[model samples]
Target: MHQPNKIAFFLFFILLIPFGVQAQGHEVDSLKNELKGHSTMDTIRAGLLIELANKLTYSDPNEAIPLMEEAISISKKTDWTLGEALSHRQMGNLHYVLGDNIKALDEYQKALALSHKITDRQLQSSLLSNIGNIHADLKEYDLALENYHSYLTTSQEMGNRADEIKALSNIAIIYNDTERFEKGVSYLEKALSLSKIEENDLFIAAITNNLALAYKKLDENEKALSLYLEAAELAEQMNNKYIEASALNSIGKIYLLFNDYDLAETNANKALALSKEIDAVEWQSDSWEVLSEVYEHNRKLPEALDAFKKHVQLRDSVVNEEKKSELTRKEMQFKMERQQAVAQEEIKRQQLVKNGYLIGAILLLIFSIMGYLLYKRRRDALEKRKLAEFNAKVAETELKALRSQMNPHFIFNSLNSISDFISKNDIEQADDYLVKFSKLTRSILENSEKKWITLEEDIELMKLYMQIEGLRFDNKLKYHVSMDNSLEPDNVLVPPLILQPFIENSIWHGIAPKKGGGNIDIRIAKDGTMLKYIVEDDGVGRSVQNREEKKTKDSYGIKITSSRIDIINHLKNTKGSIELMDKAEGFRVEIKLPLELQF
Candidate 1:
C-alpha cells in the first residue's frame, strides 16, 4: 500500500493567480479595447482565460466554469481550433474532478476533435491520456487500455519521457486493478525507472508507492513495508501531505495484516490526523475505515461501529461535495448563457428601425445578434451540463452503495458461524477457531478497503477458509491446491474468497451426502494476460434423471459467484467468466480472468 503524493489545490490556485494577473494587466485590457473598436483580439486572451480557469478548478470551479464558457465563446467567434481544443480539455478536467463523467467524456471528445483538426501531436496525446483516465475511472478497462496505449505510443514518438511515464503508470494501475499483477508490476517498474532517470521525485515517489502496493498484494510484507517507508520519506521530503497520509495508511494496513493491532491503530490514527490537516476528505474516509477494522479486530465493538459510521459519513460527504461542485459549474454556465441571450435580444430589437436609423440599428443589431447567439448557446450548454451533473451524481451514489454492501454480508455470515461455535462446549476448539475466524475477518475487513490484492495473499486466505471448513466437515471431504513455482509469487492477485465459495459448494452440496467421501482439486496456470483457475470435484455429479434438482441446488452458489464475477467484469470492463461443467465423474468449475499481478 504505497501512497502517492497529491498536489494541493492551493498550489494550482497560486499558479493561476499570476496568469490571471497577466491576463488582467495586458491580455484582458487589450481584448476589451479591441472589443470596443469592434475588432477581434483573436483567441489569445481566450486561451489564457482557459488556462487560468484550469488553475482555479479545485479551488473555485464555480468561477472557472464561467471563464471556460467565455473562452469557448471567444474561440468559436475566432474559429481558433487550438484555443477551442485547450478550452474543452480544461472543461473536461473540471467535470471529471466534479464527478460529472458523462460531461467529462463529452468535453474530452470535443477536445480530441479539435486537437485532431489542428494536428497538435502533444495536445492530442495529452487529450487521449485524459480520455483513457476517464474510462479507467468508469471501469471501462479495454477502452482505457486502448487509449493508454495510443498515448504511450504518441508520447514515445515525441520523446516526451514525462508523458510516457504517466501513460505507463496509468496502464500499470489498470493491470493492478484487474488482478494482472505481473504485467502491472512490469509497467510500474518501467515508469519508476524512467522517473528516476528524469530525476522527478514526485513521480518517483508515486511509482514507489504503487510498487509497494504490488508487493503487498504478493504477500511480500517486508518489501512492501520498505517501499512504503521510502515513499513516505520522499513524500515528507516533498511536503506532500496527501501522499504522506496515504503512506501512513499503507503502513497501517500492513500492520493490520501482520496482526499488530496497536501499530495498525496508531498508523491509521496518524493518517486520519494528516488527512484532516490537509482537508483530504477521501483519504480521511479511508483512514476511518481502516480504524474501524482495527477496532473491530480488537473486540472494541462500540468503537468499531462508531468508526464505521464515521467512515460512511465522510464518504457520503465527499460524494456530496463532488455533486455540489458539478451543480455549481452548471449554474455558472447557465448564468453566463443567460447574460449573452439578454444582450442578443436587445440587439435584435434594434434591427427593425428604419431609414437614417438603419445604420445605427444595423450596428446595434450585429452586436445584439452575436450576444444573443452566445447567450442561447450558453443556456443550452448549461442545460446539458445540469442533466449530466445529475446523472453523474446518481451513478456515483449507486456505485458507492454497491461497494458498501458487498463485504457486510460476508461479515454477518462469518460472525454467525463464530457464534454457533461458541454455543458448542468445545472450548479449545472454539478458541482456535475464533483465532482463525478473527484473522479471516480482519483480512476481509482490511483488504476490502483496497481495490486490489496480491495473488499470494488471496491464495493464503483461500487455504485458511478451506482449513476451517475441513475441520467442520472432517473426513467428509479432502482437497488439494497445487501451484507452479514458475508462477511468481509477486505477480498474481485474485478476488478474495473467490475460490472458497465454489469449494464450499462442492463440499456441502456435491460431496457431503456421499458415503465414501470426495476430493476437490484446485490448480492455477498462466494463460497469456490471464491467470486460469480450475476447480474440479469428484463427487455426485449432476444426475441425468434429476437434472432440474441438481441444477437448482448448484445454481445457488453458482449464481452468487457469477453475480460477483459480473460485478467485477463491470467494474473492470473486462471479459472474465465462470463456467460449471459436468464431467464424466463429477462437477468442474473453470474460471478465467485477467492476470493482474505485480511481480
Candidate 2:
C-alpha cells in the first residue's frame, strides 16, 4: 500500500477477526439458517445479520454492507449496544475493502464509542486497529501511530501474537514512509522475531515484506531482494495476492536498480500480471515504473517510453482520485461543523438564562444563611459572658471564706511571739520582730481581698512569713527558697494563700516539734504549663503523725486549705492540690498549681 505518500511502499494491515471460522461460506450459511427461524425483531436475528455481514466482507462486501446496516437498525430497536457496535465495525470493514476510507473511519469511530460502553476488550482493540489503518491510508501518520500503539499494547496484554506481529509491521511501514529507515528496521526486526517464534506464515510474510522495504530505503538491495523473495513465497503459500504483489513489485525495483535488465524485466512483467489478476492498481503502477526503468537501462527507447507513459498515466490518475476523495471528506466535515456550531450556540444561549436564575437563587440562600448565623453567634456570645461573670463572683465569695479560716491562727501565733520577746526584756529584738510581723500581716491582709494575685506578690508574702518566723525562732529555722529563672512571676497568677498552708503545716507539725529544727526548703519551678512547688522539712515525717492529735487546739489550717483547693478546682476545671509525703528522715509537701498567666 502507498501510506504516507504515493509510491512509498508500506504495510497497511487490517485488524484480524476475534472469532475463528473454518470457512466463510459455512459461517454465512449457518448464520442465515439461524436468522430464518427467528422473527424480524428477534435479537438472534440481529446477531446473525451482523455475523453474516462479517463472513461475506471479503467475498461480497457490497452484499455485506446492507446486511450490516440492517443489523444496526434492529440492534438499536432492541437496545443491543454490542450488536450495534459490531454492525458498525462490520460496515467499516466492508467500506475499507472498497477503498472508501472516509466512510470507513466514520463507522469505525462509532463502533469505538460503543465498544467502550461494553466490557469486550477484543472488540475495542479491533476497532482501534481499524481506525488506525484508515488514518494511515489517509496519510494521518500521527493519529495512525497513536491508535497503532494502543492496538499493539492491547494485543501484547491479550497475548495475541498474530495481531501483535501485524501491528508491529504496520507501525514499521509508517516509519519507513516517513523516511526513518533505522526506526523502521528496529520495529520490523522485532515483528520478524515474534513472527518466526509464532511460526505463522501470514504474519511472517507481512513483517518480512515491510522489513525488506526498510532495508531497500537504506540501500541494502541484496538484503532487500532476499527478504522480498521470502515474503513472496510466504504470501503465495497463504493465498494472499496483495502481499504477494507487493513483494514482487519491490523485487522488480531492486533488480532494476542493480542494472540486471533481463532479470528486472522478468520480475516486473510477472508482478504486473499478478497485480492485474488481483486488481491492485497501485502495485500495477509500481510494476510499470520498474519495467520502464529496466527497459531504459537496456537501451530500448521505444519500449521504455511507452512503459513510462503508462506508469505516469496510472500514477496521476491514482493521485487525482485520492485528492478528490480528500477534498470531499473535508467539505463534508466543514458542513457538519457549521451545523454543530449553530446547535451549540442555541444551547449556550439557553444555558445563560438558566445560570442567571440559578445564581440569583444561590446568592439569596447564602445571604439568608449568613444573617441567621450572625444572629445566632451574637446571642451565644452574650450568654457565655453572663455565665463567666457568675462563675467569677462565686469563686470570689468562696475564696473570702477560706482566707478568714486561714489568717487568724498565723496572726495570733505571731502576736504571742512578739509578747514573749518583750517579757524576756529583749527590746531591740522585739522592735525588729514587731516591724517584720507588721509587714507580714499587711501582706496577708492585702492578698485576702482578691480571688487571684500575681505570683510575684504571692512569693513576696511567703518570704515575709519566712522572715518573721526566722526572727521569732532566733534564726533556729534555716530556709532555702529556689525559684525558676525562666518563670515570669509578675505575669503568672495563683489563688491567694494557696502555697502558705502547706509551708505552715510543714513548720508546725514537722519542724517545730523537732529540737534542732531542721531546714525548710521551698523549690518553685515550672513543669511544662504547670507550676511545681516542693516544700520539704528533714525534721520528722509520720513518726510525729500522732503529735497533731495531742495538740491543745487543732489548727484546721491544713483541712481548710484542702477544702478551698477542691472548690477552686471544681469551679475552674483545674488540677490544683497538695500531696503530703513522709519519708524516713523528713516530711515533704508537693503542691501543683495550674498556672494562669496575667494576660
Candidate 3:
C-alpha cells in the first residue's frame, strides 16, 4: 500500500531543501552541527531521513521507528509541516506492517491532522487513503468508504491521476469484498482507464487483477481469465513475485472448482513454491488450502488432510495475533483510566486532610488496601485472560493438525478392475487401454508427491484417463472439453489429476448404472482475478440412495476436496472456491478462483 517511488521522491526533495536555505549565525552553525551529527539530518536531511526509514520499512521496522520519531521531532522543531506529516505517515505505515493496527490508525490520524493544517492537498489525500486502509482492515466498511471517497475527491481536486487511480482500485476492493461486484467493476474500469492514461504498467496489472476479481464474483469467468493472464504477464515483466504468486493461486482455485484436480494441484503447488521463495506467508497459506482440496478430491486423502491442517494452523495464528493485540489495547486503556481515577481520589483526600480533619492515617490505610486489592484483582484477571487466549490458540492449532490427518486412504481396487479388463478383452484394444491406464497411474504417482499442476497439462491427463474409462465402458460415454481463450495455457495451472476421480465417479456411479449413454462437459474460463470452470454430466446425478451411499463410503476424494476448497476460500486474501449443483438435466460443478496466471 505504501508506494516506494513516491516516498523516495518525497525524501529526495526534503533532503534538497536544507541546502537551499541559508542559516545566519550561531543558530545556523548549531543546526549544521546537529545535521552533521546524524547522517540523516545532512543538507536534505529530511529527505535523507525519510529515505532511510523507507528502506528499512520491511527489513528493520524497529530500527526505523526511532529514526522516524527523531525525524518527526526535527520537522516540528524546524517548522517543516510537510516533513512532519510525512514522518507521521511513515510511522503509520511501520505500525501497519508490525500488525499494530490501532497504533497505525493513531499515527495516520496524526498525519491527517497535520495535513489539514498544511497546504498540501496531495499529502492530505494520501494520509486519508491510509486511514481508509486501516478502516477496511478493521471491517468498518462504511467508514472505510467515506475515507476512500475523501481520498478520491482530494486526489481529483489536486489533479493527481496516479493517486486517483490507486484510490479507485482500493475502493473497488472494498466494494468487491462487500459483494457489490457491479460497483466494484465500475471503479476498477475507471482505474483501468486512468492507468492507461498514465501508461503505468504496475497500475495496469493491479487494475486488471481488481477487474478480474469483480468479474469472477459476477460469474464471468472468460473475461476474468483474460485479465488475470494479462496481469500476470505484466507482473512477470516487472519481476513482481507477489503478483505472480497471486495469479498462480487464482488459476489453481479455478481448476480445483471444475474438478480439474491435476491443474489445481500443479498451480497451487507452483504458487506455494513461489510464495515460500518470497517468504509470503499469506500466499503460502492460500496455496496449501488449494492443494488440500485438490488432493482430497483426487482421493489422495493423506495429502489433503496435511494441507488442511496447515491451512488451519496458519489461519489461527493470524487470528490469535489480532486478538492478542486487541486485548493488550483494552488492558492498557483500563489501566490508564484506573490510574486517572486514583489520581483524582488522591487529590480529593489531600484537600480533605488540608481542610482540618480527624479521619487521619487509619482511613488512608483502609483506602490504600482497597485500592491495592482492586488493582491486584484486575491484574490477575488480565493475566488469566492472556493465558486462556494462549491455550486456545495452541488447542486450535493442534486440532487443525489432527483434522488435516483425517483423510481416508483409497484402496487400489479400482485399478485392479481395470487390470482385470485387460486379461479378458481384445488384446490390441486392451493393450492400448493398458498403456493409457499406465499413464494415469504414472500421473497419480507423480502428483501424489506434489500439490499442484498446470491447467493445460492437467486437462491432457484427464483426457487420457477419460479415454481409458471410455474403453472400459465400451465407449458408452461422450465428453466435451472447452477453455476460454483468455486463460493463457502456459500461465494457467491447477491441482494435479483432480478431475479424473470426479469424472470416474460420473462413469462408475452416475452413467455406468444407467442403461442409456451419457455426456460430460468440462469448461474453463476466468471469473475475474478468479479462474472459473464448470463440469457437467448428463448422468443420474445425485439420486437419494447413491447420495446416502456416497456419504458413508468415507472416500477422501470429494469430501476432502470440498473441505479444502472451503479452507482456501476462507484463508486466502483473494477468492477461490468450488461448488456442486444438481440440476434437472444433470450434475453441474462450478469452480471460481482469483484470476492468477504466472509464466
Residue-level lDDT tens digits of model 2 in 245-349: 889888888876787778878878988998999788878899999987786667564465567557755765675466456555444444444445557656755
Show the lowest summed lDDT stretch of 10 residues, model 1.
Answer: 1-10
Model 2: residue 220 alpha-carbon error in angstroms: 2.5
User: What's the lDDT for residue 25 in model 1?
Assistant: 51
lDDT of 1 by residue, 1-599 (tens): 00010121211222223435555556545644544564344676785676567556665667678878888988998898888888888887777767666677688889889888889999988888777866675566898899989999999999999888888888888898898988989998999899999998888877888889888888899999999999989988987776778888999889888899898898899889989997888888889988989877786654665686677568767755665554554444444455566676566545534432656647866667657766876786577666655544444433342343334454445445545555674545655665676677567656643556787888887777766666566556788888777687566767666666677667766787677888899998887777788999888877788668877766655665566566667667778889878878778989987777665
lDDT per residue for candidate 3 within 222-314, as digits (tens), equals: 787778788778878977676778878887776766778887788888888888998877778889989877875675644654676576556
CA displacement after TM-score superposition, residue 373 of candidate 2 (Å):
39
lDDT of 1: 0.72
Best TM-score among the predictions, by candidate number: 2
Candidate 2 local distance difference test against the native = 0.73
The positional error of residue 190 in candidate 2, measured at the CA in angstroms, is: 0.9
Global lDDT of each model? 0.72, 0.73, 0.68
